[model samples]
Target: MSRDIHKKPFDEGTKAKLAIFRDYLREWLPVFIAKREIYWNTINIYDFFSGPGSDGFGNKGTPLIILEELNPHFDNIISKKLNVNLYLNEYDQSKYEALKKNVSPEKGDVRPYSIQIENLDFKISFKSKFPEMGNKGNANLLFLDQTGVKHINEEIFSKIINLKQTDFLFFISSSTIKRFAEHPSISRYIKLNSEDIEKTPYHKIHRLVLEYYKSLIPQNKEYYLASFSLKKNAGLYGLIFGSGHVLGIEKFLTTCWGIDKERGEANFDIDEDKIQKGQFDLFTNEVPKPKKVDLFEKELKEGILNKSLPSDKAIYLFTITNGFLPSHARKIIAQLIKENKIQKSSFNLSTKVCKSGALVTQVKPL
Candidate 1:
């Protein structure tokens, strides 16, 4: 049998990162559901590349992070005998053996979840398990993480993705293929993500891969991409994610987008806005046409001048409520300042970081 090429069990640093994010997700989820009661079997998590429960190599894997995250929520999860249902897929025999030991209780049925594990390689049976993932108003959050992309075909992912309520967070290692892209033969794997096979170039497989993944989802929904690196050669890998609802997007951002204490120096950590469709087109070279943002600011300027807002403080209020970029909003303020529609000596003179978090100074003069 062909062996699955992969990243070995995680180390302590990796585990710690996982724990932080797991906790982050859990924190947002409750805040996400604050308006609604969680019905039975309404939530689920799918750890597709789940390593064994522990690394013994001095790290806890996803299983450990997941269990730890779930443990606190156990009471709410337990409906009669069932805690929450966890589906764990680990291909390695050694890892599975380790997981079996860690996941079981020392005594009775003290565990709060219903779990199913497949000890075979994830590639061998990942597609086959789709139907079993099931669905609800909530969903199965599948973590299709891997050391690199392999054995993934569009058809296979479509099956997993077609689950009405299912969303995916994929670990896509982009570094490996930059060099490999020179050879057309090595590009077939990239084509697996193709949107339209007929239109795709046999050479530009990476484009196809992205298109295919996008094709698998319902459009007009938000998705996200975040990158992490072990070293320079470690390359950029995208953690691409999708969700079907706005509330999920709101929950995801509130937790994952750690507050930028300094602000606007780095791109607003819009990474947390998961349901946000397409990324904020960051300016490179020449500032790419401000598109939607420039226009939005125009409206904001009009609103500010005519006293549509009580104060420039109200402008910040608009930003907080509307989630507009500080840069974009600042453009609106800059225009208002130039037009002389709104003057200095209006609001507090000092705290002039405009409502959008971008710098625009229309401070009232002393």
Candidate 2:
């Protein structure tokens, strides 16, 4: 976890991505800070694995970005009997000290700051900070940005989901995982931890990682909870944003995705208004009805071995879901067919939340 040779100047790709993340946060925090009738006074942001702020080439970290935008809102914050708590955690003392100095005591009418620097691993630090969180009912939104998923697994994720009123936006940095996903040792780690998941196929592993967390949500009778996830890109990098509130999930996606350019690598098509307004809407669910899953099931049923030639229907659905979409019911059916592990007649819905986020309804096979 120490510094390495690759730590030269900040990676341009990562820096640009962070800029987009910060911009979205500024516009959206104001809305959340004052949106509800509920007296929203204290704002708590925990940045675990917080690296040295203002890294090489002056790439402002998330902590600084949050403070710059939020400090001004404190005018409205304390006026309404509110406080802002920024819990910045970095095991590296040098970096932590730098951050502490960066956002020190404020001037008159300035937002008051209470900062706690924990020189410990993320799990220990978070557990100490929010002991009640691992149980349930303590409202917290965690930002888990790690260099790798080596230490992050389902068990840790399970403990996090147990917290009531908690939402998580985790950066499952893929470059690290992709390197080890196919390794036998890594596969052993996953299989030993997740007994039901037999395949380590990238997307399936992605699904397993998310579903494992979802399973941790206490099956409470009074609360209607549907925990969900978001994967940024296959394994190179993905964010698993979990929320009990559906709207919060929607808002999270609306804010973060707005900043994403629809195209990749050599191509880019960022909506000017979205960019100017500092919003990320790349994955907004504008379509009224979730696209049908029949197409996905059939395509895979026929054959989806070739990645380059996605079936026409698959292409259309990909366009509909903005590349991240997948019809679980359809995929399950097709996968079962391909492997002879499941039957088509069993496709009749027995009450399951559909991927398009539609209500649990009886669905006949496509």
Candidate 3:
């Protein structure tokens, strides 16, 4: 059985993971709240594996974090006349009782939004609440902080994929998959071959697991997925965030890149970029970009010069699909124009650029 984390203070890895969760929710809430009536009439937030509200040291867990983050938005939510619901579920009985006590209104937990705490199994709770999530006028955010890798199987994942106007973040122990690649229990949920696991490097095990999940996405779907790996001693764990909208992707990427500027994907240097941090080229005496940045810029330059990326919209899609922020693409565009390799054109590389009827300018390659 997995160890009880609430029995002890949160370690560094757990703290980092919760920080990202908090940051992303901080970015997510306002978007749907501000869109009230215009796009969505309701906002639903679900935390499937919310713990006993905190660890042994009383640090806030996901459930408490959600409430705390939403506190400031109460006035806005009330003014906009939007309906916001929070569904927090914990499977363990002891934790469920503790969760109730922690967030009880008697303890000054009064708030503007509606909240429901459940002690049912995750699959059951998910099934009961999915209809509300699938409603066209509701915007949803789902958090599944499962103890192990078994909860989010292919069936549940497919259901999540089909939901519109929904964003999700789930935690997984990628190191477990790497350590037990050939084990029957692990293979029951993940179909990755042991040989492929052996080929991947230790730090990138999470990325490999993410690729397996990405393979499940249907060929025709336009979904955005990103990951942030957290390393605790020798063990590797991570969060996989998914959204079907460009704005959702932009907000998530913004939160991630804010935490990790080097790779924008991890707590530690997942790409081992320390060696190149301040290295200057002997010939030009200029600092070299990190490997990931250098590779992305090179690809963007080639695409523009070859006319493959011919417009602002195409470049915006390419930038997001390649796991980059528009600012990164903007830098390359500026450089290309200065070099006279591409003619200057008005560029509106943003989430709005992909909206229906948004103007897109052509990139004239000289």
The prediction achieving the highest lDDT against the true structure is: 3
- Please give, for residues 237-324, the per-residue lDDT of candidate 1 as tens digits: 3344444543443333343334322121112222222223344545543333333344456667656666675465556546433434
Candidate 3 structure quality by residue, lDDT tens digits, 1-366: 356788989989999999999999999988888555458878999999999999959799999999899988988888888889999999999999999988777656568889899999998999999888988788899999998798899999989988999999999999999888888889999889789999999899999988999999999999988888999656899999999998888888888899888768889888776746668888979885668888998999999999999999999989887778999999999999999999988899999999999999999998
* All candidates: TM-score: 0.59, 0.60, 0.96
Candidate 3 TM-score, C-alpha based: 0.96
Candidate No. with top TM-score: 3
Better of 1 and 2 by lDDT: 1
Per-residue accuracy of model 2 over 171-207 as CA lDDT, tens digit each: 5543334355456745543433433434444433444
**How many residue pairs of model 3 clash at the backbone?**
0
Off by over 4 Å in 1: 1-20, 28-35, 79-83, 134-138, 182-186, 192-212, 215-233, 259-366
Q: Residue 104: error of model 2 in Å? A: 2.4
Give the winner by lDDT: 1 or 3. Answer: 3
Q: Choose 2 or 3, whichever is better by TM-score.
A: 3
Counting clashing residue pairs in each candidate, in order, gives: 9, 10, 0
